[model samples]
Target: MFTFPILAVHKVIARGEADAAANGGFRNPWYGTRPRQGEKPGLWLVGDEGIYIISNGELAGGQKPLVFYSDECHPKGDTDWWDYKHRHFGGDDGIEFIDADLLVPSFDRNFGITHPGIRLTENDISFSLITR
Candidate 1:
């Protein structure tokens, strides 16, 4: 039996209805530009989509991951941070958000984006968001 490892990831800011979560994140960060060695994760606006997560190696490169989790940069929101994950990514976990559209890479890695009307649940792990 070959059991794939579960690489869970979450964003920093999660406001709006998502304010319930202390940070709306349960794991690491990965999004924006060329990911740093250990940079924190976050998205654009608050609760942009539904929060992003990638497991089963959904976002990985040639051992040169472009998305990684950091502990730094956890900005506080004026009225409570509520945003989605990064959109364009190049790693095992790419999470991003956009106001126009989310049909890009981030949405692929994550089943859905974070938004005032969106939310992340255990059911997210029910399906594989990565492409074959």
Candidate 2:
């Protein structure tokens, strides 16, 4: 197992609903950018620093957001913070918002980026992959 501390959580200022869904609703400043120094098929545990991602040992480069998470910037409205664990570093599974906090945050932050009209139950959500 390899561990990386995400000191920054960038905000995905979506142009619209479509854009947010494409990003798994959250941004990690360090996921695909830096070169992978660990083994492939590895488990990433995501918490305050335990967010786990299954790395494939590839560098897809980094992302630059308008604002980043710090003591200064925090979630607004009903928006709250949540962590995502990708089954595959960057895969299609990355789109779905799987965690418990998905519905409320997605609705508040992105205005129903996870699912619009449909009310999502816990079973409806699944693990997401980190998008590029």
Candidate 3:
């Protein structure tokens, strides 16, 4: 499941663009453009069903990350994971490359982003259970 996260109220040592170098056009699915570096989470799950942003501590604390369903959960053409400043839509609206069905709710909510349909993958998702 994917999610469009806003800046949470917390203090963290964030790095540059979630990536050290903007060298290649591609980006890591887990880290994205500005992934949390160095600090290892208690658990992490990354897959084609998008990244599930949750946490062990938050789960224990009775909190859960917002899970947005998506088509291509895996990173494509350089997805940025650390871009919390703006909303992150699952797919692009113009073409028929990536998908956006289950992501409709989030699209309607964030900037009227146009989403078409949802995607189903056979693999189980791995992710962090984050706090809302």
Candidate 4:
């Protein structure tokens, strides 16, 4: 499995975008295509905690995306996971691509507690971790 320092998460996003741009524009790997017309933006959690924010599609394996209070710890219960998923993703399990635009607020509200380096903006998000 691929493991990245939490701070390096933004590189993952940049690399994904670079790959898509080089290929022929933006195609979400998870969906294998650009989002369908009218699809709302979504976000996905990277690093050790793999969560997602999907704007459209069907959920498989009961895997709902979530924005957590901290990535330092995993979700303690199903309620925390599902609640975030439902609130942000409208309970849609069918999301393919996590929207780039939504990364900042989502990370700040969820994972920022532990990873203060999680910074977001309209253009990009930056992340870093403090090693204890």
Candidate 5:
């Protein structure tokens, strides 16, 4: 399991271009991207859709990373992770970024189960992926 930094978390109102107008003309980062396959490998942790490891070459066709999410969750929008920064991280305006990684134990995409060990505290968030 290789660890990658969680660049940003976008508040996904909806997927694809269907909700563009409501989302400021921006489609969810993973809108036109497909899951990682063959020699292509990219991964994203979606709040509503679990993890999506995209194909390597898919981004060249025009697709954004899944790091940008809706700005409605945290009080400061996309500037922070929930209220962790203000509530527990010393009450400063400092933003504490985290890292995310994807592990593909199997190539099966049929499992729709949500990871149950996702832990969110004032200072950290963690997740584990186990595809069946």
Candidate 6:
């Protein structure tokens, strides 16, 4: 399986009432505790091809996120990219947060210009594709 790193750019807040319906109100499991302010959470993307970041107008609303393959910047070396994997993800593969909007960047594009959205519920976060 091919593995890629997924980073959540933004802070996660509590969705208050919607906590129970989300992904079991689970916080990011990668860190022992919640990340400090301005800290971006990350996960590993493991699949045959790759993953896609989608979004609607709102945060974490609209459609569920989807994964697909692309001929983009797929870094698979033991450099800073690999170091990031080891540092944030313990060198393993996985996925997290709530209430807050998640800025997920496309594997091929620059995050500043284009990023998908994910809404954080108390329990879970869902992905939506953003159209330019």
- Maximum-lDDT candidate: 4
Model 6 stretches astray by more than 4 angstroms: 1-79, 101-132
lDDT of 6 by residue, 1-132 (tens): 122223332211122213323433322333446454323233223311122222111124353333322123235433344544343334444343222323333434554333344433346545554444
lDDT values, one for every candidate: 0.26, 0.27, 0.28, 0.40, 0.31, 0.32
Write down the worst ten-residue block by lDDT for model 5: 1-10
Can you give the lDDT of residue 108 in candidate 4?
A: 53
lDDT for residue 21 in candidate 3, whole number 0-100: 26
For model 2, residues 25-127, the per-residue Cα lDDT tens digits are 3333245454432222222222232222222222324732232222211233213323222222222222221222332344445532322222223355232
lDDT of 1 at 29: 35
Lowest summed-lDDT stretch of 10 residues in model 2? 1-10
lDDT of 1 by residue, 87-111 (tens): 2121123233322122234544655
- RMSD in Å for candidate 6, one decimal? 12.4
TM-scores of the candidates are 0.16, 0.17, 0.19, 0.32, 0.24, 0.23
The TM-score between candidate 6 and the true structure equals 0.23
Best candidate per TM-score, number?
Answer: 4
Candidate 6 least-lDDT 10 residues: 49-58
Ranking by TM-score: 4, 5, 6, 3, 2, 1
Give the higher-lDDT candidate: 3 or 4.
Answer: 4
Higher-scoring candidate on lDDT, 1 or 3: 3
Clashes of each: 27, 12, 20, 7, 12, 14
Model 1: residues >4 Å from true position, as ranges? 1-62, 68-102, 105-118, 125-132
Off by over 4 Å in 3: 1-45, 48-60, 72-113, 116-132
